[model samples]
Every structure is written in C-alpha cells, then in structure tokens.
Target: MDAKGSKARNKGVVACERVREEQHRYHEQDPQMQRVLEENYDYMVKHLDPVMSQAIEKVLLYQPDQAADFLAQYFRGTLEVKNYHYVEFQRQQYYDRKVRHLLALAMNSAVKDRPDDVRLYFADFFDARTKFY
Candidate 1:
C-alpha cells in the first residue's frame, strides 16, 4: 500500500483502540452506579405511590433520568392546562417559578434525607441515559 494509505489505516486502528479502551473504562465504572440504582429502585418501590412507582419504574426500565424531566414537564403542563386564566397566568408568570424553586429546595433536602437512595436514584438515572445515548 502507499505510505499515505498505510498511515490512514494506522490512524483508524488507533482511534478504534482508543474507543475500545474508553468503553472498557466505562464498563468498569458501571458496577458502582448499578449498585446505587438497585438501592434506589428498592426505595422507590417501597415508598412511592403505586402509580408513581409504576411510572418511575417504567422510566428506570427505559430512561430513568427522563422520569425527573417528565415530572417537571407534567408539573409545567398541568399548570398550563388549568382552566382559570388568572391562576394559569399567575402560575406561568410567578407561581411556577416559585414552585420550581421550592421543588429544587425540596429535592436538595430529600437528597440529604436519604443519601443512599438518592445516590442510587441518580446512578440509575445516569446509567439509563448512558445506555440510551
């Protein structure tokens, strides 16, 4: 083969090797995350309302991080869908922001409240995202 062609092939091989190495590293790191996810799964199953648990389980089984985003979206949509124009306007302009801010604070409190479960929940969430992408 020409020198240029051989060099190009070598570069491709190196890139492939690098990708494989990165994959291996990720696989190695996954076990800890998996452990966390399993713990969170248990907590969710035990503590959450049945419908909420089912919804979260569906997300965990498919796309866990999406559960939180879905919750956020649902809250936003519900606020938007309210028939009261004044309430809806207040929600859209003021209440929603305060609620979201409070939700964030609540989440932070909850994270501290159950560190292990929170860790697992996040781990599972990240794992699901990584798998999806």
Candidate 2:
C-alpha cells in the first residue's frame, strides 16, 4: 500500500485513542456525552474493527483494480451468511419451544391420568421433522 493510504488507515486508530482520552476527560463533566462516545467506541470495536482491518489488509496486499466493488461484494456476502445463520437460529429456537410446549402438555395430561391426550402429544412429537429422543 502507498504511504498515503496506509496513513489514512492508521487514522482510525489515532482517532479512537483520541476519543478514549476525551471520554475520560469528560467522564464526570458530561455523563451523557461520555455514554454516547463510549457506545460509539464499543460499536466500532464490535462491528467495524475486525472486518475493516481484514478488508483493508486484503486490499492493500492484493491491490485490486476495482477496490470499491471488491469491498462491496465482500461485505454483501458476509452479511448474507450472517443473515442466514441468524434465520437458522430463530428457526431452531422456535422448534425448541414447540417441542418443549408439547412435552409439557404431555406431562400435564399424564399427571391428570388422560392417556388419550398423552398419546396424541406423543404422536405429534414423533411426526415432527426431528426428534430429541
């Protein structure tokens, strides 16, 4: 990477340090401002730092002709994978809740000495896509 681009990349680190310093200075003087700054810092650390550092490092190393489009595609693919996993997690949670609810209903029926209700629940459970037992 050229010197200018390297310096530009390094500026984020410098600005981050400066923000921390300011945060400390204004810790008691302006609590609300401090909170806002701290939240921004945390967000940058969580969301921006890793992906940005890796993307910048890759771009610098490969020096692609269409750097903007390369970065855009990288971010898009990453976001899609993240979304897919998130959806999968939601579905798993829903399935787990449904299974637990059914199991609870079966237990309740058994406690009430209702064999038919218990049998119905077991039948539904067995027909589910996947079974825990």
Candidate 3:
C-alpha cells in the first residue's frame, strides 16, 4: 500500500483511503460500477478508488440494484492483492475482464429461473454472499 493508504488503514477505525478525482466521473452502465453488493451496508466507504467510486456512484444513481454484485466481486478480487495503482496496465485489464465475466454469470442467472422479480431475490443473494466484506 502507498503511504497515505497505509496510514488510513492503520488507523484504529480504518479510515477509508479513497481516490475522488480521476479521468472519468460518471458511467452508469460501466461494468466496474454496476456491482451487486452482497452486503447490508447502508452506505459506501470514503476510500474507494476514484475511478471505481465514479462507476459505483453512477450505478447507485441509475441502477442501484447492480452495485451489490459489482462491489462483492471487487472485494473478492482484492483478496489476492495483485492489481492496483502500480500494477501493469495489461494485468489490471485482465483482472477487470475476469471479474466482469464472473459478475455477468452471477447477475444474469436469476432473471430467468425464479418465479418472482429476480432482481430483488438476486439482490438478496448478493447481500448474503458479500455482507462480510
């Protein structure tokens, strides 16, 4: 982790280390932001990466339901601690692509098999799976 991030995480309460400025601001349909967060989290943290935060905000503004899965998968990816600010561009791209593919598989499934509004049930599922994150 960078010096600033290290400091934030080291705080007793885990102050968020976020990036608020970046190349893009809003992309409601961006795969990166359109997560299906599996948590019962009432709100987002302050330290989300700027690029990712923009995407998530857009999703929350437009497609709030998807944010759950997007975030849960993102958390899972971070478990390995590989692709981040200093990672090679290609490696980052690969990581993003892999996660996106997984999200697609998870997100699209309930739309057809369930008898009720799949979005709600799927949202619940996402919450159950990622709430610990």
lDDT value, residue 31 of candidate 3: 49
Tens digit of per-residue lDDT, candidate 2, span 25-133:
8776797877767875665566445545664554344433333333444444431222211212343454354334443543344344433333343334333422332
Instruction: For residues 9-68, write the lDDT of model 3, one tens digit per residue.
Output: 688343332222222344443544455342212122222233244534433333322344
CA RMSD, predictions in order: 13.1, 24.9, 22.6
Candidate 3 weakest ten by summed lDDT: 39-48
Assess the local accuracy of residue 129 in candidate 1 as a C-alpha lDDT between 0 and 100: 37
What is the clash count for each candidate, in the order shown? 1, 0, 16
Number of the top candidate by TM-score?
1
- Give the better candidate number (1 or 3) by lDDT: 1
- State candidate 1's TM-score: 0.44
lDDT of each: 0.47, 0.47, 0.40
Point out the worst 10-residue segment of candidate 2 by lDDT. Answer: 79-88
- lDDT score at residue 126, model 2, on the 0-100 scale: 33
